[model samples]
Target: MVSRRQLIGAGAALVGAAAWSRTSAMGLPEAPTMDSAATQVPPVPSQGPHYNPVVTLNGWSLPFRMNNGVKEFHLVAEPVEREMGEGMTAYLWGYNGQSPGPTIECVEGDRVRIFVSNKLPEHTTVHWHGMILPCGMDGVTGLTQPPIPSGKTFVYEFDAKKSGTFMYHPHGDEMVQMAMGMMGFFVIHPKDPNFMPVDRDFVFLLSAYDIDPGTYVPRVMEMTDFNLWAINSRVFPDVAPLVVRKDDRVRIRVGNLTMTNHPIHMHGYDFEVTCTDGGWVRPEARWPEVTIDIPVGAMRAYEFDAVYEGDWALHCHKSHHTMNAMGHEIPTFIGMDKTKVAKKIRQVQPDYMPMGTKGMADMAEMSMPLPDNTIPMMTGWGQFGSLEMGGMFTVVKVREGIEKGSYEDPGEYRHPPGTVAYEWTGALPEAPSAPAGSADGSSLRPAGKSASAAQADHSGHE
Candidate 1:
C-alpha cells in the first residue's frame, strides 16, 4: 500500500497532501492507496471474527482501523490511471487510486464506518449494492442522503446485516462514474467460521470499456459494442492466473458490472454455484454446471474441487468477448479467393496485401503493424503456439504439492508422457462413404429399411 503523503514527494497535489496529513492528525482512519496492479496478499485481519480473507484477482483489500468496536475505513474517490494491459492505459475514476477499488471485507452484523472523501471533479455517492442497511445509509444521492460534493468527505455508518456477495459503486451520476470504472467488490463473511469454507477463495468484478483503438479513455455514453471486456480491469495474458494445489476446494466469486451478460465457462470441471448476491444457495438446491451466465448488475459464486492437475482454460463463452479492441466490426472472409484481388490491388500499391481469406486465425500469427497503445484483437501464446485469445480469459493452473496460501504462477504445466495431444502421422484407411444420395442431394433411405416400407411391412405381419 502507498501512502498519499509519499506521492507528494514526487510532485503530486501539495494541498491535497497537506489535507491528508491534517486528516490523519485529526484522528481519521488512513485511506490506504494501492499503486501496484499485481495480485497482493489479503492483509491479515487484525481484529474481527475469524474468517479466511479472499484473494482479489489483480487487486487488493482495503485495510481498516478498529475504532472502539467499529471497523473504520477511509476511501478517497478520485481519478486514476489504470493499466488495461501491458501497453494500454485508461484514465478512470476510482477509489484509493485504482479502479474496481479494493475489496472491502467484513463479518455479518459488524458495525462498519466508511469515510468517503470525494476527490473527483463532481459530486458522488457510494451505494452499497445488495446489502441490507438503514434507509438513510443506503448512499442514494437525492432520495436518502445528499451527494458528497467534490473535495468534501461523507461518512456511511451501517451494520452489515447479511453475509454474501455484494458490490459498491457511485450512485450519483452512476452512468458516467461506473462507465469510467468506479466499482469494487464487497464481501461480508458468515459469522460462523465453519460456514462455506474453502481452501482457496478468489474474487473479481467483470467490467467492460469502450476504449477506442489507441485511445486512453472509454466512451462513457457508448452502451454496447464494448471492445474491452475485462476481469478486475485487466485483460487476458495480463490478468493473472489462478494457481491452486491439486485437490484444493476452491471458490471463485464474480460480480458482473458490464452492460451485457457473460456466460463464464471453465474447462475440466463441473462446479455448483454456492452463492449469489441474493444469498447462499441451499446445498440441496444447488445444481452442477460448467458454464454460469452472470447477468448484468448481479453476482455469482461457484466452487469446485481442483482434483485434476493441469492448466485449464477459463473465459467467457461468447467468442467476441475473448477478443480485444473493436472485435465486433470485422467481416468474415473465410475461403474467399483473394489472390486475383491482391494481384490487381498490388499493381497500384506495391506493398498491398490481402488477409483473412483463409480465416481470422491468421491475424493472431501476423506481425502486422498496429496503432500506438493498441492490443491485438486476438492475442496470447501458449506452450503449443498462438493461443488466439484475449479479453475475459485466463488459465487455472492446478498442480501437485503446491504450498498452501501460495498464489504465485507455477509456470507452464509439464504434461506426462502420452498425456498430451499429438498430431497424427499414421496412414489413413479408405474413408467410408455415406450410402448413395438421391438426385435431390439427400441421402437415400437405407436398403430395405425406409420408414414407410417398415410401416407397411409391420402392417403385413399384423
Candidate 2:
C-alpha cells in the first residue's frame, strides 16, 4: 500500500545510506564543510611585496617572513570542506583553511616570528616538524614547554636555520590530532638562493582520516577499519589535478605525521633527500632515493629536475590507504541507470522489488538506518609505530614547462600545475594521561610498584 512518492523516497534513502556506509568503511567522512565555530580562526596577513608578518594555524604560531630579500611572495591557507559528491559535507583542518594548510615561502636564515591562536576547545601545539631549533623552541609540550590550552595564543620564534622544505603540526596527542587533519608545510630558501628553481614549487602535507561520525571522541582511537586516504585532503578526481610545464625544477616538500611511514613514489625523475629534522644533513647523509621513506614525526625535502611531462600518480606505498572505504554512508542510486537500479534493488532488498523501479533510481531521496559495530580497532600492522601511522601520505605531480617544451599559456601562475597542496581538518586526540605510579604519571616508572620503588627498579626505561 505504499504510495508512489513514498516508494521513491525510500529508494533514495537506501542509496544515501549506502553511500554513507561506504564513506564509513573508508574510515573517513564524505568531504566535510567548516561546521563548528571551534574549527574557524582569524585570517593571516597577505604575503606581499616588502611586508611579511607572523601567522598562526589552528592556534599555533611560528616565525614567518623572508630574509633572502625576495621581493614578491604569496602565503595562502584557508579552511575548506572536502566535497564528497554534491550535498555531502566533509570537514578538514586546512591552511588558509585547506587540508595541507598553506605553502609558506621565505628566505633561508631569516629571523622568523609567527603568532598562533587556537580557536578549537582542545589544547593544541605546533611543532616545526623537520626544522631544527633549540630544545626550548621545539614545540613539544612538557618537553619544550607546556600545551597551549584552548583559546590561548603562543608565539614560535626562531631563525630559518637552514634552507629546504619543512612542515608544522601539533606535537601533543599527535596521533589523534594529526589524523583529524592538523598539519602544514614550511619552506626555507637557501641563502644564496638558486634562481634556477623550476617554474613552480609545490608543497603537499599528506594525511589520513578515520571518519566514523560515531567515533568522534578525542584521545580515544576507535580500532575501526580505515579505508580512506588522501593527498592534500582529497581523494583522486575530487582533488584538483596537478598541472605543470616541462623542464621546470620542481621542488616537493613532503612531511609525514601520520602513524605510518609513507614511501612516496614519483613517476619521472630521481629525487634527492636533501634534508631531515636536524636540518641539512652532511653530504654522506644526502642520498638519491626514488621512493623516499618519510617516517611519522619526520619530514623530507626533495627536488626533481623535471625532464618529461605527463600525468602521473604520486601516492603512499600502503595499498589500502589510497581509496575510499567500501561502506562510508548508505549507498545511493540517484544517478544509476534503470537496469543497474533494478539489479541493485534485487541484490540488496529483493523482497521490496516492484515492476517499475524507475522513480526510485536516485539514492538521494532515501535515508536508511546506520549500522552498528561499525567502529573497528584502529591499531594493527601499520598502527603503533610512528611511520606506519594510518593517516599521513600525499602526491606530487611533476610537469614539463617552457624550458622543456612548448609554452601553452601565460599568467601569474601563482600555483603552477602539479603544485603540492594540503588542508588542516582539526585538532588531533590529546596524549594519554600519565600512567599510574610516577609523580603525576607524566614520568615513566615500573608497574605494580610505588614511584620510588619503580624508579629504583629501573632507570633504563626513562
Candidate 3:
C-alpha cells in the first residue's frame, strides 16, 4: 500500500516539476504564476489527476493578471478514482487535477497561447478538439508532431479562429487515457458577439469509466460489460448542478470524446444547435435538437432560452453505464467455493462466480437510489431511465434572478459550491516545521535551528 506520506511527497514533486516546465516553456517570470499553485493546491494523498501545469502563451513573455484581476485563471486538473471493479483504484485524469479539465473561456480572434506540461509518465499531447488552427499547431502526437514526453513542455499557440465550444485532451494513447479522464472544455466568443445573447454558458465533457476493483485500475475498452458513465467527470448528482435564472439565455457546449456516442438530452425549452465541429452551421442547418448525439472526437454548441423555472435532470441514456453494475447481490465463488460452483454449473455459465463478487455487490449498494436519493433503480424510471439509455444528462435550474453574492442575474447559471467541496479537517496539519533537515524544508523555515523548532517559534507570527 502506498503510504500517505509517500503520496504527499510524490504530489509535491509532481507540482514542482510541472511548475518548472511551464516557467521554462513560456519564459515567464516565476512571480505571479496564476495562484492555482495557491488556490487549488494538491492534497496530501492527492486523490485524482494532477493538475496539468498551465502556461501563458502570450508571445515569448507570458502574460498574467495581478491579484484578483478580471483576466485571471487558476487552471488545474482534478484526480478521480474510477471503480473498475471492487477494491481496485485507477486514477482518472482531470483539470484543476480533475477528470474533466477546466473550461477555458476567451474571445474569438484573440491570440491564445497555452503552455501544456505533461505530468504523467506517459507521453501525451493535447488536441484542440474542434478549434481550427495551423496544421503544425494542431495537437496530434504522430499526425501533427511527436508526443510531448513526460516532464517536457509544449506550447500551443493559435488564434481563436472561430467562436464556439471546443475541447482538449491527450491524443497519444487516446483510447486508454481519454477513457481514464483526460478531457476538458475550451470556449471561444465571437468577435462581433451578436447571435442569441446569453446570460451564462456552461461546458459539459461527457465520458465513461469502467472500474474493475479487484485490479485497482479502470477497465478501459472492455467489450463485455460497460459500466459507469459521467458528464463533466462525475456520475449524476455528483456531477454538480448548473444554476440559472428564469428567462436567461444559456449556452451549453457539449463535447463527447469517449469511444461511444452520447445522446445528451436537456429538459425544458428546446435548444438550438448553433455550431458543430466544422464551425457554425448555416441558419438553415440550425434546428431544435432536444437530444443531440455527440460522436467521439466531436463537439456541439447550442443555445437554450431558459423559460421553465425548476431543477432539470441531465444524464446518459445507456442503462448499464448509468448506475453501478446493477446492485446484483450474487455471491462470488472462490477457492473451495469456486470448486463447488465449477462442479455444479460447469455447463450453465463457466466461471460465473469470479473473485470480486462481494465488492461488486457493495458497489451496486452504493450506487442505488440514484441522485437526490429519491429515484430508485436508476435503470428503470425518470433520470435513472434516461441514464440507462446512455443519455449523458445534467440538470439546469432556471430560477427568477441571480442568487446572492453572484455576478449575473438570478437566472444566470453557475455550478453549486458543493460541487468541489473537500474534507480538509482530517488532513495532516501543514507539515508542522516541514520535514526536518532537507534543503527544501530548511528553506521553508527561517534560516535557524531545526525546522520543527523554527515552526514552533514562528507559530505566533503566522
Candidate 4:
C-alpha cells in the first residue's frame, strides 16, 4: 500500500509536470509503457441489433472483450488535453483519451471485468458510484481495496445487477483527482430495453472548473469560484446538439459531478423525470416538468416526445452557469454615470473605456480583444444575434424527417412566418376615456404615460 505522504508528493509532482507540459508545447507527457500492444486493449463485443448505444458529445463509448462469458474492459488513466470550446483547452487527468472519460454500457445481469491502468504520477482508485456490487469490489481505497500506484493497474470485477445511469471517479485522493477532471459515466441497459424503448438516447456529465482566463489547468483547491461550467467537459458552440425526427421519443441522461446543483431546462417541450441513479421512476410516480434540478454527485434522466419541429434550447437555468470565464467581482455599472470618468481616463490611455455601464447585452457585439487561448464570457452566434451564452447550453434540433439511426447535424431551423415574434405595426386604436359613473378618479391610459398625455388625447377625441 502506498503511504499518504507519498501520494501527496506524487500528486504535486504530477501537477508540476502538467504545468511544464503546457509551456513545452509538447502536449501531455506520454504514458509510461504506452505501446501498440498497450494501446490495443481488447474491444467490447456487440450485443446484437437490440442494443442501441448512446453517442456521447466530445466523448466515445468504451469497447470491451468477452472472455468465457464475462465482458472485460481496460481503461487507461492519464493526462489529457480536453477542448473546452473552440479556442480554450485544459490539461486534465481523465480515463482513456477524453475527460468525463468514455461511456461504459452493458446489460443488466452481465458480469463486468474492468481493468484500470493508472499512468499519472499519483496513486488512484476507481469507485463505482451508485452500483450494487460486493463489498470487495466497492473500490474504496484504504478500505475496500488498495489504491493503484503510478504506472500500475488494478482490476474490478462485478456483476451489474441493477439497471440505471451511474458514474465512476477516483476514490483515492478524491478531492484532487476528481477536481482534475477524472470521471466517467457507467450505463447498464435494461435486460429488456424494448419495454421502455426510445428512438434517441443521449448521455452527458455536468462538471465545473475554476481555470482562470489565460490559464490551462484547473485550480483543484478553488471549489466555490468555478468560472467554467460544462456538459461533458465542453462549452457551447462546441457542445453537440441533439438531433431527432418529429414525434421521436428521446431520453437524455445527465450526471452531475460539480459543486453545485444544476436545474437543466429544455425549451418547447415538457419532460418527465424517468430515471435516477437508484433506478427507474415508475410511470405513476413520474411528473412532467420543463426543468429538473440535479444536485451534486447525482444523476437525472429525462424522457419526452419531440413533437415540435424546430430548434429549441437546453441549458442550466442559472444565468451565470450559461456563461464562461466569468468575473464574479466585476462592479455592476447599471445606471451609473461614467461619461466624465471615461473622458479623463481616455486622455491618459487612448483605449480606456468603461464597460457594462448600461448592461452586458451590447458587449457581445463589440470585438474586444481576448487572451491568447481564452474565450469571451459569453460566446455563441445565431441568426438573430449573439446567443450570449457559453457553458451548459446547446440546441435540440427536431426536424421533419430524419433517418432512424443517423447522427448528423440537421442544420439551422427555418421558422414559419407566423411562428416568429414580430413588432405590432398595423394601426393604433383611439384612447378611451373614463366611464361616466366612476367611483374612483381614474382614466384608461397606457401604463407608463402621464395623466397630462391622457387628457390631451381625450380632448382630441372630443
- Top-scoring candidate (TM-score): 1
List model 1 lDDT by residue over 329-438, tens digit each: 57878788888989999999877768888777877887777888778888899899999999999999999999998999999999999998888899988877667554
Pairs in steric clash, model 4: 43-64, 44-63, 44-64
Report, for all candidates in order, the number of backbone clashes.
0, 104, 61, 3
Give a tens-digit lDDT track for model 3, residues 243-331.
67667777676778777877777776688898887777787879997878888789887888778776666555554555642334545
Q: Using TM-score as the measure, name the better of candidate 1 and candidate 4.
A: 1
Prediction 1 global C-alpha lDDT: 0.87
TM-score of each: 0.89, 0.55, 0.59, 0.84
Model 1 misplaced regions, further than 4 Å: 1-25, 343-352, 435-462
Model 2 over residues 235-278: C-alpha lDDT tens digits? Answer: 44234334456566555556666666778877656877766756
Clashes of 3: 61
Q: Which stretches of candidate 3 lie over 4 Å from their true place?
A: 1-26, 29-90, 213-216, 221-224, 326-393, 404-462
- Cα error, candidate 1, residue 291 (Å): 0.4
**Given candidate 3, what's the lDDT at residue 214?**
32
List the candidate numbers ranked by lDDT, top first: 1, 4, 3, 2
Q: Residues 1-462, candidate 4, lDDT per residue (tens digit)?
A: 222123224644222333333533542222222111011111223342236677676566665545556766677888887888878889889976678787788888889888888889999999999999998888899999989999888889999898899999988989988999999999888888676788888888999999987899999998788999998888887888888889999999999999999999999999999999999999999999999999999999999998999999999999999988898899899999999999999999989768887789766777788887678887788988898888999999999889876668888999988999888898988887668545656577777877789778888999
For model 4, what is the alpha-carbon lDDT of residue 442?
51
Task: Give lDDT: candidate 1, residue 101.
Answer: 96
